[model samples]
Target: MKNKILVIEDDRAISELLCMNLTIAGYETVAAYDGIEAQRLLLWNEDADLAVVDIMLPGRDGFALMEDFRAKNLPVIYLTAKDDVASKVKGLKLGAEDYMVKPFEMLELLVRIEKILERTGRAKRILTIKNIQADLQSHQILKDGIPVNLKPLEYDLFILLLQNKNIALGREELLKRVWGEEYLGESRTVDVHIGQLRKKLELYDEIKTIPKLGYRLED
Candidate 1:
């Protein structure tokens, strides 16, 4: 099956061009004009293997969209005109597997896209957290035989925390690792997700917030 790619660019010219190039490169392409539309498509389309996003857009913008993708463990490449050093650094820091400046060679984009898809396709097996078990492959969370259905981001955040259990993960780290660096939203996003996970896991007091530092899962 051809890998599906979502392209979020408000400019019709750019969007259509990307779609054409992607299709010719043997990838199934879906185009959305803005962040809101892109998000709508993502919720409805479960087959998207990768996302190529532009930094500027109406409504949510690329950074915000990338945050949503990160929570779902989706691999992304930023295709944007925001080519400053800071922008590239931010995108990479936020877990974007790759960043391609706008007006880039189509061949380069194709290569980068393939590389990212290959990397993300690698196995993500079960992750054990204290007494809880998270099977990332099946998106299942279990505690002593009981099942827990976590919101997508909650699941990702829980796994990240569990993987680094007992170690302090600063707010910036969580934001960059889980939310993506281009995410300009409040840092409290991490706290909110953590709170939700703690409540759902019924592991009260398991996640500790260090004053002026960050969060950690107690061993």
Candidate 2:
């Protein structure tokens, strides 16, 4: 199936150009002129594999829109005029898979889209731990036949732990792998996120903390 992409940009010219280029690149594209419209489309469209969002939008703005997308477990790329270091860091912190500054080359955009799709596609499809089943493709987690709700980062952390399974993962390794290398937060951030995941997954006893090392999921 062709990858479906949602492009949320307020500028008509830029949106049109992106839609045209993405269509040429063999993607099914949906365009939204503002954050409100973007949110509407996202809520209604079930096949959106990825989203390219501009920071400055008419209504809720990109950051707000991104939060919604994150909740839906949607991979996102930020396309915006803001090229400052602060903006980049903020977007990355918000869980964007990629960031592209404005006036970007169409070819470069294509490459970025391809890379994001490739990485997301290569992620684990299913994760089973104890009575829990995580379906990466559908972004659903079931615990003993009951659905479990996880925040975006929590889901990523859970999948990572399951992928490693019995192997002990260090704080730095988990931070880099799940939060991206550019993440400048303290290592303790991992602990907080892991705690949240444990609580959400009802696996507090299943996740073993290795004191000075990191964590391991018990088999």
Structural similarity to truth (TM-score) of each candidate: 0.55, 0.56
The sequence of per-residue lDDT tens digits that candidate 2 reaches over residues 110-162 is 65776687687833366677899988678899999899988888888887787
Supply every candidate's count of residue pairs whose N, Cα or C atoms clash at under 3 angstroms: 1, 0
RMSD of each: 15.5, 13.6
| Residue 185 C-alpha lDDT in model 1 | 96
lDDT of 1 by residue, 1-219 (tens): 467888888999988988886765556788899888988988976877888888889999888787789776778889889989999998889888889887898756765776676567732256565678888668899988689889887887887676555656788878887888799998898888888888989777889998887898875
lDDT of each: 0.80, 0.83
lDDT of 1 at 178: 80
Off by over 4 Å in 1: 122-219
Once all C-alphas are superposed, what RMSD does model 2 give against the true structure? 13.6
Best by TM-score: 2
